[model samples]
Target: MPRLLSLALPALLAALLAGCSGLPSRSTKAEKSVYQGESFAAEETFSRLFDANVEDTCEAARRALLSQGYVISKAESGVVRGAKHFQPAGEVHVEIAFNIVCVGDGPKQQIATAYVSAQQDRYALKKSNQAASLGVSALGSISVPLSSSDDSLVKVASETIPAGEFYDRFFTLMQRMLRENTASR
Candidate 1:
């Protein structure tokens, strides 16, 4: 009886833990997704090949982002990051981040490739109780700001934008930027 109880206890605990496992199940086919310049999917990539040097590629990306009304927040040696926010309807806001990275192709030192990844996040307005300080601290009670935050409508959805038309237009614009940059110099 004691041996059976011991084995049962461990089996029960193991079963509970397995039931709560957060790992993917065997039947689930997780698609490869890339966020920013990082690739979470080993088999998937959304990068376009640019035949320019790293510096020129990154600069072109920066200009392309700015042309589209994206705010350029960071520009570094081989990486450019930008974001844009807009509201299409009431109480709904959408944000997109553009992450571009330029690197040398493994087999070709002279050839550099620029990779672009866009991540999107959606948010919705929410209302919550707040204690407004009507000029007086109402019997020494502190007041909290009424509003300034919102809840994410969904988990941040990230995917590589490898659509032919989309990337073709994007690369064409980037090429124009690269040409302009060269001309300016």
Candidate 2:
């Protein structure tokens, strides 16, 4: 009976290990092809046509961003860049950066296309503990661990904002700004 029990325990352990080996691990494996050709579609998610010149289109974009409390990083004749920060949680911070480029569609400069892209960066507050070390002439160097912790915001994720109502709302705001400018003039 003792010999049989010992042999059965070993067999059970081996079978369990073999079964686990056949299962998938927790780590994720990336697909061989990251590009699924979804970007080849003729969608107007990243760009919009305006009936204004390049300068006017870019001006509208700048105004739209400024109206939404975005800090303009760069403002050129045909390009605009802005960023806005958000804190939705106690330790989570988010920043959305906007980049807009306007180009004339024809030499007549009557029509323009504004290409816009937004990137979202997420940050989390991370706390780390530090140990203190002291060196004294009377004794050798000694290290002591203190309860001190350092907190810092670490970037957790960054990705371009997907195409959808986000861009639609921005374009709508730009259109409104352009109309308002026209009315004011």
- What are the TM-scores, per candidate, against the unseen true structure? 0.59, 0.77
What's the lDDT for candidate 2?
0.91
| Residue-by-residue lDDT tens digits, candidate 1, 71-168 | 99999989999999988888777898888888976465555788877777777766554444433466676665554443445533454454457666
The pairs that clash in candidate 1 are none
Pairs of colliding residues, candidate 2: none
- Write candidate 2's Cα lDDT for 1-185 as tens digits: 99999999999999999998977765755454446635756674799999899988999999999999999999997999999999999999999999999999977989999999999999999999977765575777665655678999999999888788999999999999998887898
lDDT of 1: 0.77
Q: Alpha-carbon error at 22 in model 2, in Å?
A: 6.9
Q: What does the lDDT read for residue 60 in candidate 2?
A: 94
Runs with alpha carbons beyond 4 Å of true place in candidate 1: 1-45, 106-108, 129-164
Error of 2 at 160 (Å): 0.8
Worst 10 residues of 1 by lDDT: 147-156
